[model samples]
Target: MKNVSTREPGLHKGVLYAMLAAALFGASTPFAKVFVGQVAPVSLAGVLYLGSGVGLLACFLVRALVQRGQVGQPVALTKPDLPWLAGAIAAGGVAGPVLLMVGLSMMPASSASLLLNMEGVLTAMLAWFVCKENFDRRIFIGMLLIVAAGALLSWEQVPVLGVPWGAFAILGACLCWAIDNNLTRKVSASDPLQIAMVKGLVAGIVNIAIALAFGYALPGAGTALAAGAVGFCGYGLSLVMFVLALRHLGTARTGAYFSAAPFVGAAISLIMLAEAPGATFWIAAALMGGGIWLHLTESHGHEHEHEAMEHLHAHSHDGHHQHEHDFEWDGSEPHAHPHQHVPQRHAHPHYPDIHHRHRH
Candidate 1:
């Protein structure tokens, strides 16, 4: 077996990225809620995602111009990444936001924001069970608490004959996003900005076409501009950070960190919309907070073996990447190029990051 030495960076950076992603996305909820009455749900969703796409496209172009001839550059997306990207756009970009806008129209912004927590729970479940990502009792317990909190949010004191369509719609949105998260993870090692931009553009265009076909009229320029701004910051920038977090933290942990988004949105909803929630909301918040705390404090490490592998991503000459370059002598610390990993064995603390996805 080839030797495998490694430089283990702390996960604090990933934690920070996840938190920032949460903040941006969370804050978008109340803003979106404000637009419900002014614009049709599907049309509003299209505007938000379109704004994300257009804004990121401009940023991506500027970065490309500035980074020309730079020694270290992120890898571009490959053709193989298309299917995953398409799935993500379809599920998250198109379906998720449309469902959310519809649900937001039917419920209080605060309640809808809290209901969005179900995305984290669903994401973790799919990551652990379907994607074969590793998890422990602590993670499981945290998921349970989050699920319970969602149940409380969906609970109704007065029985209604029909189903709680609003809550169900939000839950549907969560499931779509959960699927998108896993699909996006497959391409996380690629250029995150490009991935997000592409997703936003495709989703935006498709949804806009959908809205137009449904005879929905576009909102005024002012409302459109506001929605776009929210989309650029919340959906576009937030997704870029989220992809980076997935690169370092894996799906479940990143989803767990992102769970804080609901609280952020709920707080904003209370302040912006001045909607006071009842005792159930507070109790649900406490339970969800406890669950998030459990995930935040989790640590995992062990002795593990690495089989030979080959791929590309940004990297430095750390312990994990001690190989010869076939070309160039600039000697950049972190550059992207195709390289191979020789089979080796080692022990260390790690997340199920791109490289650390070995058998548990």
Candidate 2:
């Protein structure tokens, strides 16, 4: 049997991360829209991602310098983490955007925007079915509503499935991102900055290189800077928060929480543009609000058993981790190291967070 516990402090932190990620990403939407015609789509995407990498790398460098000579700091990204990180970067960074640009060229803007909404849906599906993230009916309904809000915001009578190759390409982008999301979770326990920085740099470089190979010229300096700024927020910071959320909330729940991004983006666009929103906008807003509330209010609990397990990630001396050390031991909290879990059984409220991933 599997038990769900919502009483953990980690889930609260996860919700905060998820919402913050949504806000940053949502706000970046309109900013990125400003760069659409000013630069080639693929080339601009590369710049944005490059900006994210550079910005985060700079932050990481500064932090390391400040912490210079500090011992016992957590080392990030073990040899085992490489394969997962590489796959995430390749799928989400390189292939996803490239496919999106291809699809956009073939389809109408309205259709493309609508199709982009599928990313959330696909993310949830992959989290639920493939990754075995747990969710009850309320959570599922919340996801559906948030996804609906996205559809409403992008709605333009774009036929749901009438498009051919173009639609397939767009859908491919969604799947790639979904896969990337799941794979990233496999390494979420690592330092988020390291994971995000590496992903941004590799993906950005690969994309830029491919674009240059095809003779895509770089945009003007001002436009490039703008794209990079947007990328820093939308892609870079958002990913950092998202990884943190995964560490707390698992995959499917995080995906559902992220589905509220479109609504946030739409609201921000309306404010920035000083344009009046239609009834549909208000309706979508209400629905999304309700959905987020459902998620926030959820309480999942059951009796479950923990099989003995062992792994490495950042952690503190919580109830779940009460083991001793082999070599020297320090009192520093939330540090990373290899650890083991002995078999135990308990009953409580929970989410399918990293520690509670028992089969139902």
Kindly report which residue pairs in candidate 2 clash with one another: 4-349, 4-350, 5-349, 5-350, 6-349, 6-350
* Candidate 1 per-residue C-alpha lDDT over 194-247 given as tens digits, one digit per residue, 9 for 90 to 100: 999999898989888989998999999999999999999999999999999999
Q: How much is 212 displaced in model 2, in angstroms?
A: 1.2
**For model 2, where is the 10-residue window of minimal lDDT?**
1-10
User: Which residue window of length 10 is worst by lDDT in model 1?
Assistant: 1-10
Per-residue lDDT, model 1, residue 127, is 95
Query: Candidate 2: RMSD over Cα atoms?
Result: 2.3
**What are the runs in model 2 whose C-alpha is more than 4 Å off?**
1-11, 69-72, 160-163
Deviation in Å, model 2, residue 312 alpha carbon: 1.5
